[model samples]
Target: MNRTNKLSVIGIAVFTGVAIMGDAMLSIVLPIYWSDMGLTAVWQVGVLLSINRFVRLPINPLVGFFYRHYSLRLGISIAMGLAIVSTFSYGIFSQFSILVMMRIVWGIAWSLLRLGGFLSIIQLTSKTDRGQFIGLYNGVWGIGSLIGMLVGGLLIAETSIRFITTLFGLIGCVTFPFVPFLTPSGKKEPTVQKTTTDQQKPLLALDQFVLTLSTSMVMGLLIFGVFSNTLSARIDQSYQDNWTFMSFAFTSTAIAGIIQAVRWGWAPFLAPFIGKYLDHTKHKQQALICFLLSLSALFALIGSINQISFVIVLLLLFQFVSTGFVTTTDTIASDLAEKGDSIKVITFHTIMVDTGAALGPLLAFGLLEYFPLRVVYLIASILLFVLAIGWISWLRKKQNDPFAFSVRK
Candidate 1:
């Protein structure tokens, strides 16, 4: 990538990273503080948490269609405005209905930001270096989530949700000036294939797209959706109040935030290395399977453990595994998108992410209503392991038939 394109990537990543602070903080905050926030039922927390992602299901494709005519600047401006307003509303509103409305607005804003970000990054880079840049973008943008959760979790004890959210919203306004300079021109690069590699053609194949989309969806569901929503709550279940670790005081909320924060804190460095590994590896498929399988084992182990000392360690370990999966899965999706129609493929990618994310809280909370947290983790572990096996089987089948993917132009 040229210096200009590289700057564009960094700009979009920072802008997006900043914009995500409010939403990311709320993952732990809302679940932990449902009663304090004027919620009457625990389930309402899940609903509020997920509603934005649910709305993104419809909103993402529309953003894709909108991009055919509009520029990233316009979409970004509208998105930033909405992000500010909605972030403020999280602090300002007590009524469930009003909060729901703001979350929907946020969903739309995120669609614009997310779809726009994906386009900018994909358009700005090529296959060889795509993984690293995607990793870099994800890493850079994740800093906002880190700070949002880390600081918000720390402050929520002393400050109100309104205070934290409103402050983050105000902070988002600072990124507005960089939008134009950072955004891509939304032009398509000519589809280039260095070789007649199967990676290019099969990405659009019915089975391949489904597998990739499924992997994307499941990762979102597990990491983005389930783990984040449940992190605090799952820990809190061991005690009615605070959890003590290492002779230092810890609330489940604080600990959850810290765990997530640490993950994203290292993301700027580790994520790119993971992406670089994918770039250099000859066996990307096997790497992805290993990530999936690792997560499955980690989930079961974390869920099964009752010891305070081990639980935190496992939880932190799980975050590292989740990061690897998230980086790998997203890189895979971007590769698929780069090979096909950028707009359409990316929209599909975003929808799957939104779907998993949307379902995450609802499923996590709802399942907790009847099942133990262990059961939930067990179920997710089984699902992941099954998915991994499916991938292995798919790859083997594809290998047996060299023409599994069409070579036609």
Candidate 2:
């Protein structure tokens, strides 16, 4: 990458990191204050956590459409403005209804930020280094989430949730000046001449897009949606009264937050390696399958095992495997995006992500009312395992086709 592209990546990474910091802060803060915020039922937490994703689902396409016609930096600046408002509002309002409204607004902001970031990185990097760049973007920006979780936890323990939340909002506003450094949308470079075979397979491109979208949706369902909400609530419920380690000084929520931080912290160290491997391997499909299967197994183990130690280990494993799948799927999507269509392709992919994230917790929590936790996880495991198998079978069928689309390392 050139110095300009590097600068763009850094600027975008900072923007993404700050935006995610707000989200991570809420993930830690919201559950602890669910009842305190006038919410009576348990299901309400899932609803509140997921409603933003629901709002994001339909708005992503519009965000993409707008990117095609407008400046990316402008869109991102507007998004950052909304993020500041939404983060600040969380502290100002305790009412569930008002909180839900703020979440809706935050959803629109996230859609713009996410789409803008993906388009910017894709436009700035060459195909040869695309995976590494995307991985770097995710890895670097992910630190914001780690900081948010750690600092939010400490602040909640020392001062107040409202104070910490508002502080994060102000921190988000600090990214505004960096917006001008982002690469503009709809800017195109000269294309290399393609062989007749490469140019003849639009259907193959569509197929790859569908596969990548499906993988992204599953990632949303398992990683972003179900695990985050369910596990945090479980920890809070299990240990809220008097659970702790290290001489029983810390509350379970604090411990959980630390664990969550560690899980996120692993990404910056691991994503670059995963990206490089994907960029150099022909077995990308097999690697993805393995990651999915491993995640499915880990989910089942977590559900079946009740021991805290075992559960923690399983959760970490789940995080590791899920990270692999997420980076791989994103790299695939980036690979499949045709020139000048990054906005459209990324928007659709983001829609799938939002759809699954929106529905995962809502549906999982609803099922929890009727089923045991183990059964719920087992169902998720089975579903993902089936997807892995189906994907492998599809790969086998396409193995012999000369025009078949695959991510080449």
Per-candidate TM equals 0.87, 0.87
Tally clashes: model 2.
0
lDDT of 1 by residue, 245-338 (tens): 7887877766776787789889999888998888776566778899999999999998887876788888888888777888888888888787
Provide the overall lDDT of each model, using Cα atoms, as 2-decimal numbers: 0.82, 0.76
Question: Compared to the true structure, candidate 1 yields what TM-score?
Answer: 0.87
Which stretches in model 1 have alpha-carbon errors above 4 Å? 28-44, 92-96, 156-163, 187-204, 237-248, 401-409
lDDT of 2 by residue, 1-409 (tens): 7988877877887787887676777776667766656777777776777788888888998988788778777888888888888878877887778888888888998898888888787778776677777777888888988988778766876887678777888788776776875656453322333567657866555566677788888888877778776776555443535554777676555566667777678887788788878877777788888988998898888888766666777777777888788888888777666453666778878888888887778778888899876787898899789888867766754665544636333
Write out the backbone clash pairs for model 2: none
Task: Give me the candidate number with maximum lDDT.
Answer: 1
